[model samples]
Target chain A: MPSAPSDSLRLRVDVPDRVAPGDPVPITFRVHNVTDRTLTLYLMGRDIAFDVVVERTDGATVWRRLEGEVVQAILRLESLTPGEALVLEATWDQQSGAGSPVAPGEYRVRAELLTEGDPLLSPAAPLRIAPR
Target chain B: MKSMALSVRLLTAATVLVLAACQDAPQPLAPEVSAASVGADRASDALREVMALDRTVFGGQDAAGQLVIGVENAGVASGVRNVMERFGIAPSGYRIEITEPIHFATETLRTVHRPTRGGIQIHFSNYLCTLGFNVDHAGGRSFITNSHCTAQQGSIDGVAYYQPTSSTDPNPIAHEADDPAYFKGGECSRGKVCRYSDAARALYQTGIDSNAEIAKTTKGVNSGDLAVNGAFEVTSQDNSSTTFSGTVNKVGRTTGWTAGNVTDSCVTVNVSGSNIQLLCQTLVENASTQIVGSGDSGSPVFTTDGTNANLIGILWGGNSSGTLFVFSPFKAIQDELGTLNALTDGTGTGGSDGGGDGGGDCTPRGNSGNCH
Candidate 1:
């Protein structure tokens, strides 16, 4: 079903503020239904509907969760009642899509829900990868 | 006097021997550095040098959480030599591999009821979806639909299924029986929830009439309504391997009967805007036509041999353009829900009543004989 509005759903991304080089970074994403009625949402198939992207301070994309992965061509319908939320978690071994480690520096991580119409984007959460 | 002199000499000799033993005693060894500590130190220094060399350089740890780094393949030799010479590190001191650079890319049914077979409107709390097919579960008649069609997923008796687009019906035709809970870890991708099928079963009330058939359209493959032109009896199911491919058909509430080619089999799909992911799902494509749409979430997918239909899966969702659709194979449903005795050979408890054409009286037709 087509979405009602972008405001009816909220997306949030969470990660540690700082981590030592070579440390595994745990990421958490939450999609909450903020509407009073149940909302049927079209989500990408595969286990990932949203993406957690890590970018350098200058806005160069360093790593993304959905990049380079083969996701099926199916849209899924998920209904969320009012006040319900889904928590998605992934641990980044600090490796980029190329299987290389991200350089230690100031970076930001954000999440995006691939919804119909405009995708809902969360604010960039600051992340600093410092040398241990 | 001679005896005293001999005793003093003996005592002096014993004292001399004791002094010699004390002088020969081993001293504590100096503190030594372990090979592991030295290697670790070198690895740390190498990591610092590598990160300083290029900001775009990706560095991280392996599954063992040990510090490791990846440099461009073309520069691996020089990079290794630079770190070794600069940090006095050996090749075994740290882990490294050739890695390419990462580039960012643009990311990319209805109801029904019963004596009621499949392809009819089914309702639950302000929503409409198609009933996929009817089955016999534990000696009782039941119907299947998408888990999202119910008020709650993964809960037994969580929602009631009704017919003809009404939740205010005096009695519900069926109550939810089983919709397996989504799981994480193991085979599921990191951070995503997964389920083998987007299917749920609803047990029919004691007197509700149903058959093991799906609605067929006489209008055309792509045209029809809630009206039933005929019925497709399910004779068997597709149990092929993960690469199974074929042209499949389905009848849903919004879009009646439509056919498409199986383009993908047993692929992991991420449901957009949700954390749930369906694993090993079938994808069908009809580039020339839109086969499924909203309110058609639970349509039964099958293939017919002119006389009987072979069950394949249940339509859950598709691409927004409707060109691509996905279904959960019956094999997956059975694997999760155990045995679901779907009526084949045209045998059912209430007997076939040819089913109604949306405009007919759908009152419980109790054993009123076969309507085939």
Candidate 2:
């Protein structure tokens, strides 16, 4: 069965400014649409072309995660029309590439819609990872 | 070295001029000592320069219409004074307080917080919120934060608060402080943002580790100072408005310890699109950068006499950027929520020691959430 249409279209991301080291942070991606035309977004294993990157103010890439770690199968393709909001969530456990806990500082977390060639990057969200 | 020699000579010349002018006015003391240094037009210009070049200091006008500067100690104070002097501005009628000294390689005071005060973590379900302050209210020991975090619409007594869901030690140090087995008392109330207040009251277990200390240190562990000395009555006693201008430091789960200036005191803010206006907000200027942020609700914003945490307000909400942090007045919380007592105001007893280490089962940094 096909889904219905929406009314508005807007993409937004929600992130926690503070994290307790080992606790995973949940970053929510919301897609709101308000119109008659239907917008299709591909969902590969439930991840809709989502990518979260945590960088220092110097633009140094500290942590990186892509949608569905190495997608194995296609989950479902969804369509968002006018006035409908689509949401997807990803969790980052406050760790770096060295598998070490990221030190406390000001970090910029950016989530993007890279499902297609042209990617829409959300304004970098300021997140602070404080001590437990 | 050359600057000091120049300042001393300049200050001597300026003092003679100011004293001569006031000598005949019957005013023995010069309140505006630095008037001659920077008249009126050059004052603002001098301030902008300090904001841009002075690294160790953050200066602003206090509510009492006085210039206030936050610094690490006397060392930076000399440099700041010299810089201002260069612009022909004397620091008369200016209040220069101290900030945590930046001594080490690390900047974030991650482990530089007191469990019961600012920079604490309180968990309800899977979410975590920062604690505003620990006080004794209504004859019961309680810790406060945003109502949205503790009360959350349908929050009941014993909703439970994990002093922190995370532990610094290998063994967890955070425990359910509100459980019957613990502090056994909790109050959660969710009021409309602007209409009322968004504050929660979580009663503590008698044995729960609690204190009125604020993280005054900008470094690690207890190596720096973080304690609450005195507080202001932002409700009935508004005479201390000047002190509020010095709204400098805040310890939160996310931002650790950040100091800045509160530009606007009373404001009605519409948080997000909630339609509800958050009343009585203390605006932390974007110029001061990120002082509050997500998951920092209920965190305590305060000032320090280098060692004491002078109570200010409890954080509520901010803009999407988290730069425009909004807070509810402490007096408003006392009036609406109805319970609050400082653990060590020479009054109620929540903690045994002042500026001392946190209690048993926890080390200097505190137990990891699992109970060390």
Candidate 3:
């Protein structure tokens, strides 16, 4: 007998208006359970693959992920029953010294959600920064 | 039998839970519409209805009560066209007219006002929302446009100038200061002095890239330029009222003014062209009814329905597809004029036949012109 689908699984992230170069951008992901059965949820930032690029308003561009380690933090939900929610947090630091200093201007942050053997889900957010 | 019954109950509950979870997630809200995509056919009808409604409610009153001046002569039209063409506005698809003229007299002069040899008009190529105005400050009177319009002092009307500051500053210092960041071309306009307003600074809080999304959502009909003629006056101290929350009727040159509802509080729209990018903000009105079209730039946007129906915004640019357009808040412009110390007591009451100088008084252009 096959098990049923899990409708309780969901994800969300929070972002800010601006960030400085080398500053840490804190991102929070939440998983909620809407079903009655307990679920074993395995969530890892590394499991997802997406492109990240930062550019100035003038067309100059740089690859954000290439300059620094693609840091990942693991989050596990041993058992989440119906109406339960879990939180996962991670920080993306604009690693300095490896690449040119991110110029001052409007920048874009893109994140894609993916699963093994599944199509990718990508959503992008923009942030403005006043360089120090 | 009892144990089997219990097991079956548990399975059923589990199945129900799984099915519920499998249901689709809530969809995100639909993006707003652009003024361009509203379609010419629908916009024309909406414009007619708004005009009819305005006459019935206001008792056949013109925009004069609202302190709007009409630009209607060939000299005015020719001058405006020259300005538009020099700014790279394609003349084939769009029309430019100076429906009014500026009248000045020697008796009204409290201070000697000399016409500077070098006066340049700032142009935003990509973004249609940006507008041009004259700025009066301690140093002198200068033309103003979006910082993104020009990089450094480029010649306009034989005047030498420089990019002073970015419009995004919250508390921008009026006089030019030493900051390489302030002098960048993409961030500042080239003129005698680049200036930004408090409203523009506040608008910068909203993300700029979001403007593209906003424009994509509220498009208007036709791809060419539009013109709007109406006067906007400050009715209250809290210039914050600059963003009026109400239904408004807009009258423009091409698809004469129409009526619509404002949706957002203060929206910043970026109009991008090959040579210029202008960022402007205005009260976002979402009207199930259409009200404006191309060649309506400079149209006045106001509400005749509410007590606050005073002058609110000046039509600058919009997206036809999403039924959304951007205007400069009247308060912002008023405040800019005030900051420059240009609004003289006499100039306030003076009547001129020049563009934007006619104040809010309305005179009919066509014989027995019916507003409706």
Candidate 4:
């Protein structure tokens, strides 16, 4: 994923409001270029610029998609035309960062576009992990 | 951190405008011309002189989207014409107005719970600012921020500091502890209050948790109560005025985390409003867009080596055009506070904690707590 000036871009995070225990939670991050002209963005290469983090209700982070993964050091420029939307998808297996099964509870999921400037952030979407 | 004495003297725009505006001339439409479009050779020279007078003076635009040069008073209004005439610039091409002095006075994606650290938003009275770094002060917990953000800029008035924003009033997390007074005369020129840095330290209330680690990205939602993802560790510092040329990252509340290059180091900035002048300030140009905004003062400035960071300074002011900003280095900050060190990763051991100053005579702590 590529990152640009946050004010010129809009980010949205989509997650299921409720999911049964042990079910794979699919998270979608969509970035739209709302400006009138094409914008050049900084790419961290290899989808490393995008991250999905799930946190407990107390604001404690439980799982982050990029945790412990070595991100490539390469940075390149990519262009996104106006009105175009970029989407990235990831699945959280309901596991904590330490590889333990996450407890059935309420959590919030958010996405980030890590750029050289302030990272463009998406509102945290609420999700409930309950045993059906 | 190496220390260097700054000797550059800069004249304030108010003084120059007063000198140029003494005479009256033909009235011209509020100088509405762009300096960039002011012709080729001669206009460029005039633009250079205008910039040399003061970078902050002629770089902003007014509401109508026209380039505006701010003057100190209506009398100084004619000074704009005088400058245009002296430099052979056409008065028909530019706009000028009698405007008040630019001020660095103003958010929150920086709210956090207990165990606060650097780069988070802090509120006092009706203003907001960023916490520069958590430090070990007098065997207690303290944080660094801009003096202007305090109840008073030149004196410690025991002002209470709230986290996130002013909505959490009456429940202050810290109180003003150390802030050096601004002096006039001697090293400072006449008619101005001078200070080595616009920095002040606040002692955290008892039981208020904190760490030396600065915030970065990885976890958090929008601008509301951002979850901690503190990864920055201050391994070293640059307190010298030898003109730095490298990438520095600023984790400010308004602009979250932004990177830029040091455009000017150890330059003197004459903050116009109250005749206050800051000495040995570092100026940065944002890499892409506007980075600094209101309420971002005291934001942590540092250089990172992938995982670890070298603490640089605290942001204080930006020009009307937010592309450029100014900060005071750690040397000036320490010159006022005396032998301080950044407490990183909750470890009290100076320098070894990877976020503290090693050579200070102050006693280091032992594991302050979880920075994240």
**By lDDT, who's the top model here?**
1
Write down the TM-score of every candidate.
Answer: 0.49, 0.42, 0.26, 0.46
lDDT of 4 by residue, A62-119 (tens): 9987663322212224578999988877789999999999999999999987553455
Off by over 4 Å in 3: A1-132, B1-238, B274-280, B283-290, B305-309, B339-372
Report the Cα lDDT for residue B274, model 3.
16
Give per-residue CA lDDT, model 4, range B1-372, as digits (tens): 111433222233333433245455455334456556666565656545554553234534445444456554655455555666897767665555444554321122455445677888787754567888888765356788987777756665778888865564457788877666667556665566677777888877777777767777543312223334545776676655435677777777666676778888877776522456677777778645665755567888888875677887888766433466778888888777766678443432222111222122111111121111
Q: Give the TM-score of candidate 4.
A: 0.46
Residue-by-residue lDDT tens digits, candidate 3, A1-132: 111233446544455777775677665545566677776443222122222444445545554432322111111114568777665444556533354455556766544332211212224456676655
Residue B119, model 1, lDDT: 81
Candidate 4's displacement at residue B5, Å, is 52
lDDT: worst 10-residue window of model 4 chain A: A68-77
Judged by whole-model lDDT over C-alpha atoms, candidate 2 comes out at 0.50
Better of 1 and 4 by TM-score: 1
Q: Output the number of the TM-score-best candidate.
A: 1
Worst 10 residues of 2 chain B by lDDT: B179-188
Over the stretch B1-372, how does candidate 2's per-residue lDDT look in tens digits?
A: 001121122112222222343335332443633423345556666666656645454566655555555554444555656667887665574545555433323222233233345555555544456767766655355666765563222133345555444433222323222211011112211322233344556655445555666533445222222222222221111212322564456666555566666777765554331223445556664554555544566667665655555576777655433345666677666655554555342222333312111111211111111211
Candidate 3's displacement at residue B202, Å, is 24
Model 3 C-alpha RMSD vs. true structure (Å) is: 28.9
Give candidate 2's error at residue B288 in angstroms.
4.9
